[model samples]
Target chain A: MSMLEKLQPIFREIFDDESIIITKQTTANDIEDWDSLTHINLIVAIEKHFNIKFALGELQSLQNVGEMLALIEEKVKKNE
Target chain B: MNEYKLKDMIVGLTQSFSVDITNEMMDLFLRLSGDNNPLHIQREFAKGMGFSDRVVYGMLTSSFYSTLAGVYLPGKYCLLTGIDVSFHKPVYVGDRLTITGEIEFISESTGQVEMKARILNQKNEKVSKSKIKFSLLE
Candidate 1:
């Protein structure tokens, strides 16, 4: 599966909606429940799904799903 | 209050202040924020959920970062632009928390200073941490 495909399920699960289709442009403004509290939950879920850790600084810099997927791909490749 | 210029802030400049989390403070926050979550206001409900007592609203604990930046770090003539916080533990009534802010970075171009903010309970456990961004005002 592609990175977007892998990430799509996680976003759906975090948002508790099956219809969330994410692209590089997808951001907090596009989601209904993407407040600060849920943002942490989404980050934690993404970290666990990817089996990686995100530094607080890195977390602050990610502004969209594409950036997040790029970071995840980079981290996963580094770990392999 | 001391007016801090962007050049005056050096990495490792620090300030510390303490606040006692009293029931009255919680009540005041509850009213101001209109956060009527039972987890913070109802003892039996909180106890049922495994907390020893009502959990003081997490934002109330996090609010100290504002106090740290606006009152002490830059002290005077400061405008808080942003804050990113992580809550590690729940705060309960009567827990005395020491809030500390340390300068981590200063940008001369933007007149913005980034500070690492932390809140530790009397037991010396960190309950919350935040990175706060502020700019010195003229």
Candidate 2:
């Protein structure tokens, strides 16, 4: 599946919104009810799925989808 | 909804946990949000702002509610369908916060449950309260 296809379920599960459609530039502010706790829940779900643990700094530094994709790329490379 | 089910949850499930406020914990939360409110970073600024010292982030206390949900309910049990939170008072450094929650309502068919959550200081001062709702399953 493409990255967007993969990220869709993460959005749906974390925000409990099956209607969520995440674009490359999607940010938390774009979605209602995407608060901090839910953000952590999303992080935990993503980590579980990809089996990559995120550093506190990486999690804190993520501002949008581009940053998330970059971080995922870096994490995937490190693991490889 | 089974009256016995709600009573059983209240009697056997609800629990309370306490955590003391510290500068380290405060700074961790501040760092996470990049919230550098001088009132939270400096004692004099806090006092000047009518507070004794740095106060806890309102969301920090709210997060504790998640801790409670994760522990008592466990796993996806906290389908936590909905929630509404309100900040009532400020938590200060050195305050011992006791987070307490109780089951208020349950609808088995609808798969919805309502809970009342509260954060109180050692002195029993209410710091925050919320009406939280969750689903028993997906």
The candidate that wins on lDDT is 1
Chain A TM-score, structure 1: 0.93
* Model 1, native contacts kept: 0.00
What are the per-residue Cα lDDT tens digits for candidate 1 across A1-80? 99999988888987889988899999999999998656765766666677776664676777888898899899899889
lDDT per residue as tens, model 2, B14-127? 657888888788879888999887877788877888976776778877888787665654323465555678988889878899987777654432334567888899889898
Per-prediction DockQ, in order?
A: 0.04, 0.02
Candidate 1 chain A weakest lDDT stretch, 10 residues: A36-45
Candidate 2 docking classification: incorrect
TM-score of chain A of 2: 0.89
Clashing pairs in 1: none
Residue pairs clashing, model 2? B80-B134, B81-B134
- Give stretches of model 2 more than 4 Å off: A1-80, B1-13, B73-76
